[model samples]
Target: MTGDGPGVTLAESGEFAVIDRLVAGRRQPPWVPLGPGDDAAVIACPDGRTVVSTDMLVEDRHFRLDWSSPHDVGRKAIAQNAADIEAMGGRATAFVVGFAAPGHTITAHAVDLADGMWHEADLMGAGIVGGDLVSGPQWVVSVTALGDLGGRTPVRRNGARPGDVVALIGDLGRSHAGYELWRNGIEQFDELRRRHLVPHPPYGQGEVAARTGATSMTDVSDGLLADLGHIASASEVSVDVSLDLLAADLDAVAAAGAVVNADVRQWVLGGGEDHALVATFPTDPPPGWRRIGRVLDHPGSQPRVTVDRVPWHGTAGWESFRVD
Candidate 1:
């Protein structure tokens, strides 16, 4: 479909045609009994329980077109939502996306977005079952991810107890380090720059922790302190994080901090969007996780997280209403 000129617009292609392009060559996982083209998608939950989570990414607030390609934005929308299921010790099985953009937006860009979403979903043996498209003021992507627990009880945030060890798997603060590098226009840190645009969450470690008897688990979407605080509050426990245990994580971004004259500790402790899984284990953590702290009985009813036994006075994490 062509518009008045050479470069075709979504307005010219119309809704059904553009959607056809988005789902044209895509393949669905076997669990998807009914994929796109129907009024609804049918996903099989063999374990008899479904793990579900949803997230939204708005233009400019969550991402900048100048900074992220449409493909990058698509990967991010699916990744963040899938991370939520991982936090609950389940594997993502399928996703449904609702995307909105101006009618003038290029149809090819929308197709690229779908391609990026498919690429990330394929990493975890998941599928893009269904979604919707609409014209709006700006780009917005809303994703709902469904997962399977494989008959294991979901590891909750309230099961931690005194003497449990705190552990984490996957990179921490790398995305924030990339954000700093991208904002300051310093192009030396190529990996960091890419991380800011598209995060790489530990894909399958959630089930590993669950199998290893994780008492409580969560993905680090917020800063380490803020996210750990959720577990502490739920479990009525106090947590102490040993910075000495985080030397490798710190060293990973210390050089970037120096280049920007920023505090590396804040990036690691207060930064967010690493999507790394953190959990409490009664014994030694599984092979992929590193012990970073310990859970203790709360001194008072109010639970808290500390770095070296002291409260963090710096920035804690990303506040949704205050994204700037």
Candidate 2:
């Protein structure tokens, strides 16, 4: 996809030029004492404890060039890493990136990716402090995010107690619906298609949940049931998700479901990549959070997650090792 016509390839621009293009004209947040053009960036953690998380996205496996633009891929990469920090009840402060792509790729695309990263980072008042660029056969975006807890306790999956209120903030199943539409070559549902490309993670709700006394917290990177299963197992408690509580989420995707002739429940339950926050609260959840389920004591030795008290046999989440 490389040619002349006002665009230079990475091979033509050279590695240094490509890196310069990515780092140019970008501003850093106050938390970053030093940004690019140095050995490494120095970041400040306000609460003295740093929350760190990292994620990697591969071309074709995690996204398709035909389906997502470089900008969309960049946003997805940064957003997912940010969600990891949010799941730990922290707010992202600084980000370091490592990007690799074919030498034939256009340099402008790499710049676009950086712009997208900066755009997403700026949403939560964070910044891209530093990153590296390299040559590879296919595009790979890796990000390491650092966060600050603001003196709140770091919430974990094992802290969900029986009788805690299980709640969700952000969205569910929209990404799966978008994936279905894209995979089937459907042209309708523009919103769902866009959601598949760029997820909308709840920006500050992690700290809000923490401040409100969340017992357990996690981002729904996999299927809802699969992620909740983590909480259930870690906390050794059964989780019962009420369908009546999820009616709004179900209705939100009902039209897309009918068009694809697929059950929306599976999309909401089994689909992943929405990056929504789900947590168990000891009391009432804060504003904008939806009450979806409740934590319960395990009847036996094993703890599990159920939908309306019934086992879900469909796909529960994304399995990276499974061959599609």
Candidate 3:
């Protein structure tokens, strides 16, 4: 209902009501010992190891309501953090969210956002568990996810050996291309644009990699090379990404690159937020993964991310306070 006429803002509907509507009609998985509507949801940790990770999305910084729906933003908040858990070779079990928005925002928007979060959480057989709502200058959503190791050792980022092969799953460069499209007012490539709004991570592949003897892994929240640099730095090894293996991804965005006067390869290698999974394996990687690079002996240079044996010149990765 509107404040004066037909349509009112979120400020009019109220926060509690919005949350109730958002949470209504959602279901959690059987392993979720506790679901939403509680202070915190608990899950069975038979292996006695729990994986936890958190991410924060600030308005304009992480998302724009103009570009994404409340639902889309909510899903993204959960998905990115969950990807962190998956990168550690764990299955997500629950989430706790914190939402900060203006008091005048419509309650319906809040509910819709929560609905989106729940929808995405359901995809991994997890639950929202609990969350907090507060007032703020702009919309701010923070999510922390808890995961179960299922009796397997958690995969860290420092285990790669010199002979380990680097592999990747999920699409690359599409999000960056989409971002370019949106920024430059180029209207072609609807699929790329949609990807900017919602990233599709390869679910369950992390565990598969873990089972297949993956030595190290991390989500590509940062760019492909930038993320791999984390592993390289931690393991004291060098990484060399093969451009040939990434040709298809570059091709996918070549047209978009032309439209925006950008290099598709740069997007493939440097653009982040696709949330793709990249891992290192001692043997052949599992199915659904593509070999992209190899680990090398550490030369004792300051930890760096490189491609073709040299530092990439494109925007390397995302930094919280920097602009592209």
**Which candidate comes out best when scored by lDDT?**
2
Alpha carbon lDDT of each predicted model: 0.91, 0.92, 0.85
lDDT of 1 by residue, 126-244 (tens): 99999999999999999999999999999999999999999999888798999999899998988888888888989999999999999999998988989999999999998999999
Listed in order, each prediction's TM-score against the native is 0.97, 0.97, 0.94
lDDT of candidate 1? 0.91
Residues 224-278, candidate 2: write the lDDT tens digits: 9999999999999999999889888899999999999999999998889999999
Which runs in model 3 stand beyond 4 Å of their true positions? 1-11
Off by over 4 Å in 1: 2-6
RMSD of each: 1.7, 1.9, 2.3
- On TM-score, who's better, 1 or 3? 1
